[model samples]
Target: MNVISDQRVRRGRKFGQVLDGARKVFMRDGFERASVDDIAREAGVSKATIYAYFPDKQLLFLEVARGECLRQTEEAEAMVTAEVPVRTALTIAAERIVAFQLSDFGQRMFRIVVGEGERFPGLGRQFHDFGPGLIHARLVHHLGSYVAQGALRIDDLDLAADQFAQLCKASIHEKLIFSMTETITPELARRSVHGAVDMFLARYGVGG
Candidate 1:
């Protein structure tokens, strides 16, 4: 079922308000631990008001999570521009990817989806579609442009895009994701982004 179908979720002036509240609660408490009462209290709406907009906690959490992913993807998209050199564009993209992966919000969302995904697989799919899937699509679009311009020589855009995205997460991502580190310093993030851009350009840049 479409959890976010318009028929399933009614819209209202307070819709955004409720989503904001639920995001905070879900981020703080995860899906299973987050209570409707807590979400209603955080949203500044009554339980009835929340129910009037959303049918249940799962749908509400999905909407909030999807919205957050879209928001982050849009922000990353906005940072990449065609006017810049391919190297600059790639560096910017890598930086954005690394920063998002290292963010507290991003980490929480990832954990929530991982924790609840087995019970509700749609949650995992929704997160992937809106987050990594969207990001990969954007990379393919931009990388195609670079290839067309003869700045990059990628024969497999999909594989190249996925590689670059993974490259950006090389050093720091696993540490944070596996709970080996509580925080990443700016210097570490910079090294990862720069290393990713350098490796990508070496493999795909003109004549590379």
Candidate 2:
């Protein structure tokens, strides 16, 4: 590789190491307890190396949370497309969202944010803006196209999008977050997704 390519590759490797270490530290000890020293130790890098990639523990944690959110968003985005009917596309996205939220990594990241968010005021906002906010924007764009094509009638596409997203969670999200149960059955997720789609179509469906 050329000099620039080599440097880029090295940076990418370093970034991976830092994120891996940071994820472990943050998930193990919570945000307040996780320190740069601990992350560096886990990552097998120096404190300076951690700082080079992230300015502070908060920023590092933010990146971790953002990474998870982006991963989930990408998966959901892939399922949402105009080629499919609105109901089908939404059901696909909802199922994926529920699956992601029910995963161990998803619950862990959610706990970290909720538990330590108050101490770091900007942290929660940043997470929401980057994560759910991005997903909402994408949905809005997708829905807007249907609206233009006369497939739906939504006075407020933004509100409609948010509602569908929340509806996907339905009865399962809170229980998962609070550890109310050990498992989220596929049947439950299907119920939630279908219910959300039915409700959304009730209000926004083109025919009725």
Candidate 3:
């Protein structure tokens, strides 16, 4: 099924305003608790204006969440250039993954999706497609380029991409997801990033 209905939303100058207001409300009150009235108030627009852009609240939430994932993915992709060394690129990607997993926005989005996933399976699917799925595809693309150059020897680019992503979350992700910790220090984040890169290269790098 289509993730969203583009035809339903009328693009206007206040389209962004509606989304921004919705994001703040969703971040504060989550999906169930967030109201269109609140979003309208926060966005500084009339309720009718919001309905003109978004037919329903759920659609608004999904659009807001998808936009955030796209923004982050683009930022990470921009950092990994063809000129960068394989190891350096891997390090940069791993660092971005870990940082996002530990970020307040990431954590909030994860909780919101997981908590409401059963009722709205599309939310879960859209989140995965835009977030982890997109990251995996990008990683596979980058890894394939290195493999073609014989810099890395990967039999399965997909698995290797997934492995690298999971490696980046080694210690930090579990704790934060479980609420075992409230904060992640720079030292801990650095350790996870470096360790993920080392382990990935050890297995995939040439001559391994």
Judging by lDDT, tell me the better candidate of 2 and 3. 3
Off by over 4 Å in 2: 1-13
What value of lDDT does candidate 1 attain over all alpha carbons?
A: 0.85
Q: What's the true lDDT of residue 182 in model 1?
A: 76
lDDT of 2 at 186: 81
C-alpha TM-score for every candidate:
0.90, 0.87, 0.91
Q: What does candidate 3's lDDT look like per residue over 1-208, in tens digits?
A: 3356545666798999899999899989998899888999999999999998888776787788778777877897798777888989888898888888987778888899999888775778867776678788988999999999888999999999989999999999889988898789999999999999999999989975
Model 2: which ten-residue window has the lowest total lDDT? 1-10
User: What is each predicted model's overall lDDT from 0 to 1?
Assistant: 0.85, 0.79, 0.86
Off by over 4 Å in 3: 1-10
RMSD of 3: 2.1
RMSD of each: 2.2, 6.0, 2.1
Preferred candidate (TM-score higher): 1 or 3: 3
lDDT of 3: 0.86
- Give a tens-digit lDDT track for model 1, residues 102-121: 87778898899898888875
